[model samples]
Target: MTGSPWYRDGRMRYGVGIEDTFIPQERIGHRKLDEYELTQHYARWEADLELVAESGAEFLRWGIPWYLVEPAPGRFDWSWTDRVAAKMQELGLRCIVDLMHYGTPLWLENSFLNAGYPERVAAYGRAVAERYRHVWTDFTPLNEPVVNAEWCGLTGSWPPYLVGDDGFVTVMMQLARGMVRTQQEIAAANPAAVFVHVDAGFRYEGETSPVPRAFLDERRFVGLDLITGRVQTSSVLGEWLASHGVTAAELQWFRDNAVKPDVIGVNYYPGFTTARIEDGVMTPVRSDAAGLRDLVELYSARYGGVLAITETSLVGTPEEKIAWLRDSTAELTALRDEGHDIVGYTWFPFFTLVDWLYRYDQKQPDEWFREFGLVDLVRGADQGLERVRNSAFPAFRELAIRDR
Candidate 1:
């Protein structure tokens, strides 16, 4: 998977995300999962992925938990990563490695409130990049900064559980800096590498952007600019930032130091979007997953880069999910016909995830996040856990191959 030649048009290129690839056994150590339990879990994940690769996906995007990577701030693990990378290479798939997918090493305690966290993360990042450079091609420094920052830092909604807005700004800026730095190191080692500034595809129902309220767009593109170094301290907007204690010097520094993502990844999901929240269920209002093709064109125009929908799922109800996927694929084809840089389309995870973070049993019970996957997590006494592949699997397989 490392150092493979990929190209777009005449240049080397490919599209597709690595699916159902996070490991429970590796990051937290074998403590969370037993060897006896993983036999089917690992196999199913690999099988579904191979199926996606067969659909003409050039590379897969997956992450390693920081908590799992470095048990201590400086210490690291390479064994689990090596095995996964090798498997990907065996399957003839290149990989886009995501360093921290919103969470940090448990030792860091998910400390978004601290300014120093990102710096330490960068040090660890440099090491991880050097190690994985041998196995992966591209890299994503942080995934979904807007929501991640909000959940982990600003709103005090997630782990490390801090309250107040002060931490949010600090954490986001640090991440912006960290991502730029991570890409720099990775680029230095592998001069040909590209960085994907990956963003969650959902919009907040507030201020400026797409959501009904003006606040929706208010924070919509916030993540992109932060990573690209667009936020500054001296402007009118800087005043608002100052309310949270962002200083002029730091803001200017970030603006001057912004690092642009080589490819901007738009990761989509079904859970966050809504029609009218009818009866508290987020019905599909405007969705490519529903054959309502405009969103594809909207995104293509919004971000002028080789575009790919990183993760799109029709969460809940196997039948609905299947129908949504079929619609999404067909709509993607339409976008391609319209000459959108529609590099490639993807329906992700290929398998089920470790129960979604967004949908906890106690929290957001109505959202149904776990059902977005293409497989059902079922364990058999003899087989361990198996991915009872959904009906959409065969349909997607058939479509993906037709073009691949």
Candidate 2:
């Protein structure tokens, strides 16, 4: 804590998550998919910020659209983000700016596969940092890179959909490069800048036979390992990448320019975040405390950085969500007391968010709500989005104050 920023002081950093992810569609011909716009965040920015501040959380996992700001290459616009930066300062909410969530601008064809992707993303990160030099905005250059790669490269669910192991490695490398470059640029702009490397923390369990648990386990850490330069030529992941059509130069580049994270931000959720494979079928394992403790230990031993429960929320009723939040906080507090650098806890998505399955094709939920936020997104009689604070609000509000 001596040299680290004031925010990283050993005190637990409780925060509210602002769910903002934009995914482009290769299935639907290069169209943009924005969660913020779909969730009415653009229309209710001030209200949303107020809700986060009023929740008594110190940090907000915020995002701004790179495609909107950098409409075209070398041409930048800071109008929208300028206002956001000012408001965050006024509200006393420290932000962990998510520079690239999951998508790119329309101009960047093949998305993460594009050779210029790393440089382009780095440029945007640098521009944002320089523009907001006075504001103490921490950055998450890329969020959930492993999931981004798997969805875009392996499953053919997202843009530039490529269905193969080669595509997966390619996307992962591109993301790693972008993260490293973006960190470098942001740090150059402000030496005080800190980065919370956010990734989905998963634990895959199953029968020892039929499935190679070691392979899946090693693969889980590949994204973070590569970013931190842990993938040596003789390493299991490096060998796997070499066999999977990733060029020798690409592997060497990651080794040469790896960037370690300042904070290890683990995005944990209820279902499917921790899964078990029994007889080749995968299922969710429902023990938040056990999962959270294991993750804190794993990351603490492997990465040796200040850790954070960056995202955790349930989609059930308010009581159920509150129960999960309490359990999660207990685990995090236990870890912190045991001398682990577990610095923060976050209730992701302060309000209800629109479903990503529709990907902006449908305006709002027609049938029922996903209901993942502390507040519910209900359709009013006039058909506009209404923010209804659930029982979890007061509970989390009190918890945040007690933790501080």
Candidate 3:
């Protein structure tokens, strides 16, 4: 785990992740939402790392809040992160550090659309790599670029708000550029670094839909395609992007400086990963193991590299959660048996997290809490939110130990 890359270790790795999104901006009347604060992770980070190690997980996908770490243009405060990184290494847990989750520093004027975003984010990536190259080697430049663009561009819920397909394309271009530069910076610092490009695995269904299934399917891979330089003029999404205002030179820029992921981490939740779009309205369709298998196969066929279920879980009763753990792992095992390069499976967010809706509504964290982890969060009057281990904890531990 220390010298060689874990994905190259010839084992099906098992890991857990903490929900580490830090959107620090409040638009309209909405309040900012930081998962670490809501879950008290900052105060109890040591205990949280211990809990992850205790669960028999070898890896942890966590993020550093850029807004807090870099309050000024050229200054950084790594005191808190230095401790967390040290503790993670001490616990023998391999860290796949998430460099960007959603938000940027308040000092960054226009968020993702800012002309200097790519360079600024790359600078942060370089600093992180230089600081913790020994403690961890895996890095995710940004988590869920599609979701980032959706919230910030398509829906106009986040910073530098721009709506419609044009906005999404604009934001995606900036993200892809930043991601490429971030990967380059991290590699310059640590030549042996591994990049796990993580994104939400979106699946759209419905024969009589407003958006063509073919287009949506192709669109799902647009973010990944852009980074890897797969969106050429002859590609399916190439013309669509051009029609939206992307020029030939902009498309060629990605081709000239493409950065392919060592492992494509697709975050899939059976409860809401797949959807049915009808007459322009989209509805979440609850899917099961079969749905997961389809997504794994799709990504594998497209990227043809090491693939991992970077995030997946059910927000349901203990029984339902346990069932998903059994079913999903079984399907992945079958895929591995059939010669798929599926290297890892991660039950994301080791504990509960505040729902994203909490940011737009004035409600207590407990009210908007989601039970998607092996551990549950309970509100304590004196101690804030307490981490309580539920039945799924032991179940997931058993799977991790048995699988690894």
Give the best candidate by TM-score.
3
TM-score of 2: 0.94
**Per-residue CA lDDT of candidate 3, range 1-404, in tens?**
25877787778888999999888887777789899999999988999999999999989999999999999987999999999998998899999999999899999998998999999999999999999988879999999999999898888888878898999999999999999999999999999999999989998766637668988888888888999988898777999999999999999999999997999998999878998888977788999888888998999888898999999998999999899999999999899998888888999989999998899888888899899999998877895778899999999899889876
Alpha-carbon TM-score of each model against the true structure: 0.79, 0.94, 0.98
For model 1, state the Cα shift of residue 79 in Å.
1.1
Clash tally for model 1: 22
Q: Identify the candidate with maximal lDDT.
A: 3
lDDT of each: 0.59, 0.82, 0.90
Shift of residue 121 alpha carbon in model 1, Å: 2.2
Residue 132 lDDT (model 2): 88
Instruction: For candidate 3, give the lDDT of residue 71.
Output: 91
Candidate order by TM-score, decreasing, is 3, 2, 1
In model 2, the Cα lDDT at residue 134 comes to 80
Question: Where in model 3 is the C-alpha error above 4 Å?
Answer: 1-4
Candidate 2: the clashing residue pairs are none
